[model samples]
Each structure stands twice: as structure tokens, then as C-alpha cells.
Target chain A: MIIQDEDQLTAAVLAETERAGDPRVREIVRALVRHLHDFAREVRLTEKEFDASLDIVTRLGRLTTPSHNEVRLMAGSLGLSTLVSLMNNGTEDSPTSANLLGPFWRQGSPRMDNGESIVRSPTEGPPLFFTGRIVDTEGNAVAGAEVDVWHASPAGLYENQDPEQAEWNLRGKFFSDAEGVFAFRSIKPSGYPIPTDGPVGDLLAALKRHPFRPAHLHALIYKPGYKTIASQLYSHDDPILETDAQFGVVQRLIGTYERHENEPAPDPDVTEPWYSLEFTFVVEPGEAWLPTPPVSAQRSH
Target chain B: MIIQDEDQLTAAVLAETERAGDPRVREIVRALVRHLHDFAREVRLTEKEFDASLDIVTRLGRLTTPSHNEVRLMAGSLGLSTLVSLMNNGTEDSPTSANLLGPFWRQGSPRMDNGESIVRSPTEGPPLFFTGRIVDTEGNAVAGAEVDVWHASPAGLYENQDPEQAEWNLRGKFFSDAEGVFAFRSIKPSGYPIPTDGPVGDLLAALKRHPFRPAHLHALIYKPGYKTIASQLYSHDDPILETDAQFGVVQRLIGTYERHENEPAPDPDVTEPWYSLEFTFVVEPGEAWLPTPPVSAQRSH
Candidate 1:
């Protein structure tokens, strides 16, 4: 059909929803058509330019890989990741603020006992003693909640992506004990730059934007019969907290790093002074919680 | 802005385009808005579904790569490649029909003298002799036109991707002699399957579409003071000629392969007697034609 006007074209596309075989696809396509059309209109796109934009998008698809999430990076850079996360996690009343699962989560992380250190190196950075509890919305402890945690090292590389780090270094899964408590010894995460070598970097450069993400620790908490919480605890003082490329910063998700100064401890294990953070995860109760598909499941087109 | 209805959203977006800083960006954005908004209205998209669609597109951006042009494959499957090619090529009449340059063009092909065989395999397939000439619109020889040609092996794999074939096998660059005549010995090109291991494949599977491209040889003709042409010559009898996955089929691009029957003076040097194809390219007079930046240029996004 010759789509002369925007209205006619939109109406035609929306009408396809009724004939769409998959309801999910139909709804998704309709919305996509709207937003895409809206974005174009908002930008007053020309034919040649629209074609060029399509070319850009096409190139993006061709550049994807297991280690590189250019598509996800684009989404995150455009604030779409935050938008999706917000839409999915609408129970904003919950204590923990959700964030985008920034492209580095992998399966098969070794499980660790309570209070086990996730950091493979004891002297990597300022020692951080992190303690957290899993609780229901009503403030009652929820035992057996599994918490998955991971972070980049001082050099700003994930264990999986860095060959120098052993397998699953600085990454571990901890199950909350009877008291619904979990603790792990690790270094404070340093501020780092996102992978800026791909299309996302090109986009950021085009927009005259920076690619730094604020210092933060990644966390995913899950419990039976309760909504799983995917969140990050950002350092309160990190400069990028306000302008995170992924739009992932939330006030509720910020945690304070307390530096314990000059407290003489007799334990030889506590070599030097350290910083600590104590936080609690309050999950919403419900069986209707939306399940997050594993990264691999979502990796395919 | 609260985009309650499609019209208001379109208007809002169009107004925003007026404020766009870059004229090119403004024109492109306007067209994009119109097409995207029209598509949305045509589909009657809902907010919830729109959000999900946004997520999927974002993920697609994260998945881009140099070796894998998944986004291009997706766009091609959706007929976007043909549309872009048509728009770029304009309405000029020409001797050969243009087609999408499928993602396998490699650089630094070995230059061959006229009449040299592009086929390196002695036992690969039936030997075919291809003769071609470059001429102007008035049918006069246009010497010095460089013909770049490459094709898949009998097993339907490009030399670069296949380990068995030596580098630059079944691929060569030959400059037309002073008479504008060029010929090469090669096996008859065979139909090949597009890569089906990525999101592009997933999209095709979702659409219940086959991923076979008809047997064809890719060619790029370059000459000073004339329009450079990038095209493919398809075998007339290929079954998938009508329904190419990328919608790249054009009637004028099909070439007839004539079987050379038993001639008493069998050329012993040419083992496995096969067909012959002779075609000529007519160039349109112009300044040195500049080809579009290759698909790789936009891949870093």
C-alpha cells in the first residue's frame, strides 16, 4: 500500500494486530510501530535519512555476539532499558530499585556458603564487608533466598571477560541462611567505563556523551513465592550516578560506604582498615511476579 | 508529552523536528517519525506492548558484530535491503539489475589477467566458461573497467569461511582488456543457505520462511567516468529465484546457462564439460562513480 499520510499508514499497521498470529507479537508490533513512528515524527525524519537510520540499525544487528551486546547497549544508552525495567518492576514501593542487567551476567556461578568472600584476591582494593538480609514486604525475614552478586575488578574488567581472572572470580552465589541474612567479603567497586569500542560507543560519541558508569555492586535476589529483585547498589558519591549511560541510577538503590578508620582489631585476617555496607532487600510477595528469562534465552534474536 | 492518540503524538513529534539542530537530522527524523508513527497507528499499538517492543529493539542493537550482520539479515528478510537499494539507485535504466550485496564480500582479492580461471578446484563441480564485456550506452567498448567477481564453492561456502578452500579460491578481480572483453573459468554457481544460527534465522523461523538464496555470482563493475554497478547474476533455473529471502530478484538479472554438448575437439584442459554464459555491461556516462560505503562501515554501531 502507498502510505501517503502518517494516519493512514498507522491505521493500516494497527489493523494487522487483529490478523496477527501471535498475540504477543501483535501487541509488540503495534506498540513498536507507534513508538518508532513517534520517534521519527519527533525527529522529522527525511526519506534518505530514514533509510540511513535503517542502515544503521541493520548494521547493529550484524555486529552482535555472545560477549558483545550492541543491541542491548543501544537500548541501555537510549534509556529504553530503564523504561523496560520500570515497566516490568512497577511495584515501586519495594525497597530495592531495579536496574538493567548490564550485559555481563553469566550462568554457572559457583555457590558459596554464608559469609564467604567473593573476591578471589584479598588485597585487591579497600576491603568491603557487605551484609544483607532478605525480607518480605511486611518486614519478616525470608529464609533460603538466593542472592547472586558480581562486580568488575580494580582494573575495570569482569572476571568472565578478563583472561587473567580465574573462572568466576569476584562472582558468587550466596543463599541466605535461617536468619535470612547473607554476607560476603569483597572490595569496593571502582567507577568504570562501559565498553566503548562498539556501536554504542559510536552513538555516544555522536551525541557528545560520556560512557562512564558509577561505581556499584550488582545483585539479584530470588526467593520462592516472592518476586525476584534485580538491582545495583551505587556508591552515594559516584559522579556518574546522575547521568548513568543506562539510566540505571535510583535514589533508593544508593548505598553508603562506611570507612572504618584506625580501629585496631587483633584478628590477623583483618590486615588493614576497611569499608562496609549493610543493606536489606524487601521483596514483594506474590506468585504473579514476572520471571526474568535467563540471559541466554534472551540472547537470541 | 502525553501521546493519548496517534495524531497528537505525530503532531508533537513533527513539531519537535522543527527544533532539531541539524538540518539533515531534522529531515531524517521527520520521515522516520512519519513512517514509524504510521506503522504504529496501522497496528493500534498499546503502551504495554510498545514498551516490550522497545526492549527487543534495544537487545538487537546489543547483538551486532563485524562477522555477523544479523541486523542486516533481518532487514534484508523484511525487504528493507531492496527498498534501500532501490532508493539509492534511483530510477535510472541500466543493462543489469542490482541486488543486495549479501554480507560476504571480502577485501584484497587477487587480481587476475583476462581469461584466467577464477575456479581453483579441479574436482569441485561442472566447469563453466563465463565471458563478459563492458560497453557504453551506445554499445561501444569501454576499456579499463574492473570486474570484481566471487562465488560460493560447490558446497555453497565462500572461500574465506570454508577451511578446505585456499584463500581467494573461486574469487578474482579482472580488468577488462583494451577491447573491453573479459572471461573467466569457474564452476557453475550453486544455491546457498543464508546463515541460520543467529537472530536473523530466528526471525525467519518465526515468519515460517525459508533462508535459501538462488544460485548466483556477485560482481562489482568499476570504471572511471561512469556509474559503478554492484549486481548479481542468477541462474535462470534456480528454484528460489522468485522468492529470494532478501527480495533481491529482478527479471533482467537472470542469465541463461547453455550446456555445451560433445564437440569432437574436446578441450582436454577443461575437465568436466559444462555450460557457458556470455553477458555484457552497459555503462552510463558520468564522473567516476563512487560506490556506497560498504556494510562494514556501519557495523561498529
Candidate 2:
């Protein structure tokens, strides 16, 4: 298999994959080599560009830490995460509520009673009383499901990514009641710029693209009989909802943030402009499990 | 720009590239996104598999250093390096004598006179006397060109990778004579395994592929009026030449390692057997420049 040109190079690389023991590995690797070679051929990629890409990839790995997963961030920024999520989840007719479980998920979220506040530490923002009703494709209630919820604070930093925030300040795990309803009180989450200190940031600046993700609250629901659904409910009014940096937005995932002014606040201490968000989560029947947390440690000062 | 499915995901991502201030960046990045999303869809890449890939990508960066370039190695292993080299080097007919400047290449090789051994320290193996003639497409001699030569010792480690070896062992820069000829003396290099303590190792193992590259000598020739050609001259008899791990071997680059017996050796320390290699390097007229070094620091004991 002496390679004489680009085609021969591609063929030779594909030929070697025939020796793989696993059929799935063979299939995936063959496709990868084909697409990878095709990319080089399509762009007629130069050695100089190839070299620079290697540096960027190297930087991706070097910059990743327990608090920041640069590799995953780059994938989301490229839209592969959303593509994979859409392709793998849901039926052909009914899309699954499944979405990307971004790098911010942390495990061991403290269990809280429905309607209790997940705000473990003092924080300032308009209050949000969010309610979710878990249902099946038939619109039947799926009760007793464990729903894990978390979101960024008003300052646009996850508890794990900001040291000033107390542990699990905006994170909680709530179990649905007999009516398949779960609710929690927290601050209204808003769009924020992704961390720009890494390679992905360089890419955003290079593309003249903003790094803002539309405001969203993340939830991971688990039950034994049904598939686990990891989803994000985007704020419909966020300016960048149409241009989410992570490409996590989907039409069905957008939740309305109904504003109420001069209305009775859920807590008497709360002032005006509090909000309410209600959405239904649909889960399919399949294997159910938890995802390994992507980010774990809090940022150090 | 709402991404409802995989195709929409791809379209949205590509559309964003339109905003890139640099046209070249837009083109390359758009093609990359299309191909990347296509790969995920073609494989229906699972969330678990996608997550695993991020870990692998992260390791590629974390393992890379001034001395070890795992990201580049992964690219070469996948044959992207060779495909790009073949594409940008020469026209369709007369293939350019260009090859991949593998991560092993370093800058500032010491200058040496014609026929001087690059073996700056004691090493084991059969001695080799190599000569290279520089020529244009018309077979005319190209004079006053500089030829940089380097190769691994029989132990399969470059000087920069082995602290036991003296400074710049098996590396030298030589000026071509007025006759367009440059010759050097060194050990007959042999095939060796690529470094396998990282992601590439996992890939090779997963594919049941061998990691050895055929024995070859590397040369980077530079002249003001000609394109700099980075090349690898393969031993015709090397078993793995047909299955190079880096996909670096080309038909024209294989050189016959003529053997001698009971003849006077080039050195006064006579030996019964020595090898000689003679090949002509053809460089087309174009810009000439040196590449940045990929590896530098020596391995610490």
C-alpha cells in the first residue's frame, strides 16, 4: 500500500481498518478516516494550516481542567453536540426531550422538597418559580421520577465555576409527586458569554462570533422504566437565543419566562418583576441511567 | 437559525462561518463543520461515544509537550498529514518529492562537511553511506542547495528523545556540492514503534493495527529558487514499507540499499559489510523556507 497521491493515501488508511476486530470500531473508524481525509481534500489543507490546527488541538487538551472541559466546549461550539443529540434521541415523529448534557453538570445535587428554593446562598435577581410536569408520549403522567436541576446564577457563573458561590447554590434534585409535577424556586437565568480564555474563545473571536449562550436551566431526569432525559429550557426573550454559542437551542426546548410585576411574590421579601416558568418534560421508554459529571471542582481565586 | 435536527444543525453551524472576517478561515471552518457533523450523523454517534472522544481529545493535548506532540502524531497516524503533503506539494503528473516533516524533526541541526558521519556519539548497527543528488524536473543539477539530514538510531530514539545520546546525535546539515551532490555517513536506520503511551496507542490497539513505521531516512532540502521538499527515503527491503503507520511511504521515495562485502569501507576502520544509498531529490521552482521544529527538549533520565 505505497501511497502515490491523496486518494491512495485515503484508500490505504481505510484498508487498514479492515483488520479491526470489532465491527463497530471498523465502521466508525472507516467513516472517520474517510471524512477526515475528505476534509483535507476539500480544503486542500496546507501543511501550515494543518500545523496550526494541531497546535489548537494541543491547547484544547492542555487547557481543560476539572472546572472547564475545553474539548467538550469546542465540540458544542461546532454544533456536533446538538447534532448528535437530535440524531440519537426521540422517535421519528416525536422528538425526544433529550438535549446536550453540557460540561457543567455536577452530581450529588442535594434533594429538596417540591416548591422549596435551591438557592442555598444569598443571591440577587428576579425570582423564578419553575414547574415541570413529566409526561410520556401518550401524555400520561410519569410519577416518582427523580429530576436533577441546576442553572447559572445572575452573574452567569455556575456554582462549580465560581468560588464565591456556595456549594450547590443553584442545584437541586427533586422527585416528582403522584401528579408528575416538580417545582422549585430560583433566580431567573440569563444568557452569558462563555469563558474566553481558551482555544474555543480564540475560535469565536476568529469567526467574529459572539460566545453568548441563551439563558437556560439544565435538568437531568431519571427513572427505572424510562430513558433519562437531559434538557435545557432556554429563555425565550434572550437576544442570543437564535445564536447560542453552544448551539443548544431547539424550538421545543424554549420556555416562556412570563413576567409578573406588582404581583404577590412567592416570598414576601421578594420585590417586583418576579417570573414563572412552566414546561413539560417528555421521556421515552429505554435504558435509564445517570451521566458522569463533566465539571467537578470550584474555581480557585 | 434554530437547529431542529442534524441537517439544520449543520446548516446553522455553516451559516455562522459566513461572519468570519478571514475568508480562508470561513472556508476551512465551514468544511470542517460540515464534515464533522456528517461524521456524527453517519455513525449516529452515541452520547457516550461522543463523551469518550472528548476525553481522548483532551488527553491528546495534555500529553503534548515541547518534546512529544501527541496531537500531530494522531493526525499522522490517521494519514491527514500525508494527504495534505501530497496535495500541496506537486502537480498531478510529477509528484513532488515532498513528505511529512514528522514531529521528530528539530531545528538547528549542526553543519557538517560532505561524507561526515552524523553519528556524533557511539551507536550500534550496520554502517550506511548515503548520497543524494538534487535535480530539477528537466534533470538539470541544482547547485548550492542545503540538505538537512536526520534519522533515529538503531534503538529507535532521536537524539532529542534520548538523554543518553550526545547533543545532536544523528543530525547534520550539509551543503550540496557544485555537482548537486551531498553525501553522509550514518547507521542503517531500522523500523521502530511510535510512542504508544497516549491516545494513538489506544487507537492502534483498538484497530488491531501495528504501530511500526518502516525504516527510512528523512531529508529537508532548501534553496532560494525552489520549493523546500521534506522527504523520507524508505529502505526498499523494509517489511513495513507497504504498511507504514504514518502513511509516509511513496513509490518514488524508496531507495535501494546496495550492500557491499569484503570491500574497503569509506572509513579507515574497515568493515566487511556496509550499505550505500543513492537517490535524486527533485524540487520544483517555488518559495523556500524552513518549518518550525516540532520537538526540542531531550528526554530526562
Candidate 3:
């Protein structure tokens, strides 16, 4: 029916949306309209404020490109990404910890041997040897699982964001060994700021919030029978872990990184400090799916 | 503080935002976060749905430019613009009946003398003679008030949207005569559909809602001591008045436009079928201000 008042207007919008071809789409639109209308009323949003919001949101879209996903960044900054991941993955109280997909993940990372380095350039900082295992809830090893790993360079820049780094400098894919183990090497990542030259930066500054995410390694594990888990392993000792700007860190996902100095390198080729990281992923029974990466490595200049 | 859970994360985000220099900005951000979190929880939003929302909202921004405002159009399509306008203006139960400041309202309309026509082109349609008065709460005429009038031509296109129409055709500015009266002549406006090639149009189709707004004349009044009102007068007999896509028509704002056949024109020069629209605007007490036009007429082709 045609709406004649504010309340009726909202209802009509929702009612008409019920005819959507997809049931899920219908449900989502209904919720969005209801929540949005309630928000306007709850705040008595003024015209000026509404206009300001439209301007900021529009800028967010304009700033986004194949190499930049401002929408994803905003979602993470607002905690919605974390909330959605947590809610869908496991029970809120004790689900396997998951983190943001972030804007740096790329599709079709080059497959590498178990001990090969994902590092393709002469990067600075301590060498990091990372190892992990994927298993079902029963603790049995899930052999032949695809593990996609990526992280920033020591200087806090992703390969895509830094012109000095080689293509896919710190990105690689590995297959778990028979015992459900996967291992790779790279330079340890350091805490770094999100891109702040755009609208998100303005919001962070205005909110007085630091734009830094704690140093962490990203892993997307996939197996035919287990639910794919897009996860991050945070450096437990990093100063910003507890205050990650993306709100992506969970206590369960933080792991200790053992450091060794002046010791023989694991490969016996390096004469510098090195670190090792290890963790295990608990998978549930479901269809394995991969998230669309927020940004791709190849960007137009 | 370091966040350990969803609640803690939300609290930390809000805490960090308290540093905003402007209190109003702080309040708005706080409300925005709370409502956003609540909406996610209410819907148990999934990652796929979240991604879809990001795509649609991003398109809204990308589709916008200096001459076109897809964001404003979306806001109106959702009935948000009308809601905000009404809530901010007169009381909910008895508002002075404000409407949307649609994208077609160009600033600095050509000034015209009382009883002159806003029409500058050889347009073909029933001649429309419009008149209105501005009064205060005490019902006293508001002399010297400025009235800005604009409307689309019978072909359902504004001057900017149609090259056939001269620059500023069907747009004019006039001052209230000593008796608080203003008048002009132009072709009667026809009901029109909003631009449907963008995201807002996609939404209208998905929601199973029409995009047509009833034929109406826009007016922006300005007086030194009274609040400037941006309003629209809807044709009482228009079929779509009860179902304006923008939800902008109020019961009190609808008025009858009397049609005459071969009658003596209100202005002695006219000898054709014509229509006359008469209405009174009640200005509330407040500072006079003009809203920033959402889009400009001079666009880069």
C-alpha cells in the first residue's frame, strides 16, 4: 500500500521489498530499511548532518579502486567485519577465532614447497619461519590442505602498497604435509598504519584513534570437506595487538614468536636474528569457500 | 583500553571517538556506531550479505559527480530525506510541509518582477500562472521575502536535463510584493521518473517500488528573521500524489490547480487555456539559511 506517514513509509518500503526474487535479499533489505529508519528517528538526524554523511560516504566510494577497498577498510574499522566473521564462523562464546580478510589478500598466490620462503626480495629485519597445522575438531591431521599465506614487509608495507618490493614479495600458497603441517619463511611483519590519506584517515583522526593494526600473518586454509577459515595469527608480544585498529585480534589467535640471536640460521645461510611461529587451526564440517580478496596486487598507476 | 570482546571492542571505538573537537560530531558518531552494531546483531549479518552491501553503497558513490547526486537520490528513494526534513522543520503532527531540495534546483535563478513569467523558451503546454504568499506564525504577511521557484517542463525534463530548453528555463526568483505576494507563469510540470540507470534505480527495481514523483512545483523562501523553508506544492488531483516515490507530499501541502478554457488570462496578454496555482507558506521563527544545492547545473560533459 502507498505510505502516508513516516511509520507507514518504512513499512511500505519493507513490504514492497518482500517481492525481491531472492529470499535472502528480501530479508536483508527489510532489516536495512528498519534499522536505517530507526537510526534516523533515534538521532533526529538534521539535514546538515545527513548531507555530511552522504558526502563522506560518497567520498569513500570514489576513493575505492582495484587496489584500494575503502568500503572493506571502513567495515573493519567499525568492527562490523569482525562481528560478521565471528558470528558466522562459530558460536559466539567459543568459535575458532577468525580475523579480517583485509585489503591485501590476492587470488592465485604462487604455490611453493614447504620450506621455501614466501619472501621474493632482499627484505630487511629478522627472518621469520612460520609453521601451522590444519585439523578437524577431532584433532586428526587434514593432509593436502591448501594454505594461502601473506603479510607485510618489515617496513610495514604490503607488496602491493610498496613499489620497492617485488611482485608477490611476501605472498605464497602451500599444501599441508601428510601430518597436517605447512611451513614457510618470510621477514617478520611489524605493526603499521592503514592508508590514512583518504576518508578513513579523516575519520580515524577525528575519532582520535590510531590507525595501526598489530603485526600479524594472514592465512586462508581450504580443504574439500572442512569449512574454509580466513584467519590471522597476531604477534603476541606486539604492543598494538590489544589495540588493533581493525579490531581483528582475539586472545586465542595471538601466538608467541620465539626469537634467536647470533645462532645458526635454520637454513644455515643467514647470519642474523630469526624468529619462529607455530599455530593450529580447528576446522568445522562445511563446504570450503574462499573469500574474494578486497584488493588485487596488480594496480593501475 | 584494549578490547577483548565484541562489547569491549565497541566501547573502545566509542571511547576513542570522544576526542572529537566538536560535540555534535561526537554524538553523531556514537549513535552511528551503536545503531550499526545493533543492526548487524539484529540481522545476524553474514559475510556474503555484508559484501553485497559494500558493493551497492560503493556504486552509489561512484555514480555521483558534481552535476549529479546519486547519494541524494538514494536517500530520497528510501524516504530518508523527507523524514529528516520534516523532523528538523515544523512539529511532526503539524509541520509546515517541507519537501526535498531535488538536484534540479540551481542557485542564482534569474530574478523576475511580480506577475512575470519564469518561462524563457517557446514551450508547448497548458500555461500555468502560480501565486503564493509568505506569512509568519501570527498570520501577518511577510513583506520583502524572497521566493525562488523552479519546476520541470511538460515533457518531464528540467532545463538542465533537456538541451531544447533555454538556460534557466522554467526557473525564476521573485520578491513578495508589499502585500506578501509573489506570482509567475510557466508550463505545468508533469510527473517524472528519477534517473534509473544507477544504483538507486537498481534498488527501486529490487524493492518493487516505482520511481515516479507526482507533478509538483518547488519553492525556497528566504526572510531575514524567519526560518528559510524549502517546500513543494503538489497538484491535489494528481494520481501519483498519494504515492510520491520520495514520500515528500504532505496532506496540507496538496492544493487544487484550477484549469480554465479560453478564459481571460490573469495577465491580459494570454489568450489560451491556462491553469492557476495558489498557496500560502507559513514561515516559522528562526534564522534564515539556504541549503547547499546537492548538484550544480554547469556540468562537464
Candidate closest to the true structure, highest DockQ = 2
The Cα local distance difference test for each model comes to 0.66, 0.87, 0.81
Tens digits of lDDT, candidate 3, A76-157: 7777788778777766565764677776778889999998998898888888888898877778889999999999888888
Evaluate residue A89 in candidate 2 and report its C-alpha lDDT on the 0 to 100 scale.
80
Residue B109, model 1: lDDT of 66
Stretches of candidate 2 off by over 4 Å are A265-271, A294-301, B264-269, B294-301
Which of 2 and 3 is the better model by lDDT? 2
Q: Rank candidates, TM-score, best first.
A: 2, 3, 1
Candidate 1 share of real interface contacts: 0.09
What TM-score, over all chains together, does every model reach? 0.57, 0.95, 0.93
Best by TM-score: 2
Per-prediction share of native contacts kept: 0.09, 0.84, 0.55
Predicted candidate 1: interface RMSD?
A: 7.8
lDDT of 2 by residue, A1-301 (tens): 7886766778888887887899988898999999998998898888789888988999999999887778888999999888878877886578878888876777788999999999988888889999999998778899999999999998888887787788889999999999899999999996788888998999899998899998999999999989898999999998898888899999899999899999887788777789998999988898999886544533344
Of candidate 3 chain B, the 10-residue stretch with the lowest lDDT total is B292-301
**Would you list the rank order by lDDT, best first?**
2, 3, 1
Specify the highest-lDDT model's number: 2
